[model samples]
Target: MDTDALSPLLSALRDAVLDGDARGAASATERALGQGVDPQRLVDGALIPAMDEAGRRFENGEFFVPELLVSARALKASQAIVTPLLAQRGGVVARGRVAIGTVKGDMHDIGKNLVVALLQGGGFDVVDLGTDVPPTRFVSAVTNDRVDIVGLSALLTTTMLQMKATLKAMETAGVRGSVKVIVGGAPVTQRFADEIGADGYADNAAAALALARRLMASGA
Candidate 1:
């Protein structure tokens, strides 16, 4: 394995992530790591760029939400291997802590799962509350986990209304002001997020990570 011939390995990793092929991405990551390619190099060179490109395609209507979610999952598969190695090298940087869930009555997990992968890829410790998460569970997770951001997801118009209920529950539980709430999902809109008093709104997982970082940076 000529370390000088890293281009093929790097290209394979990038293409795997872009194709949303989890096993392929992970296999490529393992080969890269075994060949002594810098883990940070693979992350910066392959994972981030793949996700960024996915975001661009999503925004341009060349790719849909599900495709982006699949790509995020693939990035996460490779990220899992790269992260621990980066940590051992004392090179891993955590952006923030996040607790995210699809609101109660919304059983959609793909979007929330995508956000989970993206958050971890962005170097945040994420506490995933899973789909159809109740308001009590959201509050409990935030209070127990000490998360920097709380994210609500809803894939249906009816389920999006649960975001408001969840917010109210958090306010009643005295946790609303303790953390920033960001909302997203198919039916979610910026107007709805603002009306519900959410701190931020993201149309997709990549944007969710950016929003979480900004919310945390704002001291929320």
Candidate 2:
């Protein structure tokens, strides 16, 4: 396919994702494949950028959870078409492995759920630990699964303190350096994340996905 033919398909993918059209996104992905376009071209060129714009809007207050979920679902739809192809072709490394859960003492899950969806959509393998996950479980997951990132969610001021404890546990188990720790939720802040010695903090799901990508790239 000529570059000119590829341009409209890319635009279609971007607009479909911006509009949160999952069916449209999938159709665009399949069509791109039929056109002999590189799968990575669709993923890196269109899908990631669309989600990045969606995240920017979410952070800026122009989009909310509903819009973010819509875009995430759209990305997942497109990813469904691309993943197997990459696997069969070989030499395609997984983006990363992520272990995510609400911290011990937190029962809220809305934000964590969104983060999980977006992380998978971004091509990361995710293990959802449910709400109120304990530090011991996190340590086991890291050591057993060889997790690349540990994402913590805490909705209450009280539960937020567990983030520090969780980090301590990782250090105690000697797994702290093997994985990057990222924290989020309504009560989480960059200052708190720093105090807890976390590797990153995101204000929302899109930001969380971006943070995961960065940490993966940097081997954090």
Candidate 3:
């Protein structure tokens, strides 16, 4: 399909997903597939771009929690439909493997989820450990999954400390240098990342993608 023709379908899919209309989103996804839409395009062109807009709108105060939730719901719905197709196409090879999670005591997951979406869009194989993940869990994932990078997230200042401790644990476990570390969240800053010996830090999801790619390239 031409870009022009695909734009509206893509938009509709975004709307449907945001509306939490799973059936409608699924219908739209099927239609796009029938029209020979590339599965990657559906994710990168449609879903990820829409979520990026949502994130922008959120940062600008044009979108509130309800709006963000709706948009995320929609994107996830569309993802459900398209991801399987992408999987069938020999599964997208990640730029690198990453194990990601919210540090212990920090239950916030919105930012983590957004990062995961953006990472997936950027072609990373992400093993998400979810919210309130312990330091040991992160280490185990790194060891078991052989991930190229480890991303630690914390939304609260109190919990942000967990990231540092987690890094320390990695060192004690003798796997600190085995993988690059990236950290982020509302309370995190580039300075803090440096203080924690993190290889990189990003303020938001888009920047996270760029940083992840750069880290992978430099490490490789």
Clashes of each: 0, 0, 2
lDDT of 2 by residue, 122-213 (tens): 78888999999999999999999889999999978999998999999999999998999999998799999988899999997768989999
lDDT of 3: 0.82
Question: What does candidate 3's lDDT look like per residue over 1-220, in tens digits?
Answer: 7889999888877777656576787788889889888876776666666666777787899889888776666666667676555444333676888899999988777567767867877788889999999999999987899999999999888999999999999999999889999999978999999998999999877788899999888973
* Off by more than 4 A, model 1: 1-91
- The C-alpha local distance difference test score for the whole of candidate 1 amounts to 0.83
Residue 166 accuracy (lDDT) in model 3: 98
User: Local error of candidate 2 at 176, Å?
Assistant: 0.7
Error of 2 at 10 (Å): 26
Please give the ranking of all candidate structures by lDDT, highest first, separated by commas: 2, 1, 3
Task: Name the runs in model 3 displaced over 4 angstroms.
Answer: 49-71, 87-97, 105-126, 143-146, 153-162, 183-192, 201-220
Q: Which candidate leads in lDDT?
A: 2
Q: What is the lDDT of residue 15 in candidate 1?
A: 93
| Per-candidate local distance difference test | 0.83, 0.85, 0.82
Clashes of 1: 0
lDDT of residue 146 for candidate 2 = 81
Clashing pairs in 3: 17-74, 18-74
lDDT of 1 by residue, 1-220 (tens): 4545888888899899889899999999999889889876786677767866887798899989889878878887887787665444322577778899998987766557667766876788888888889999999987899988898999788899889999999999998888999999877999999999999999976688788888878887
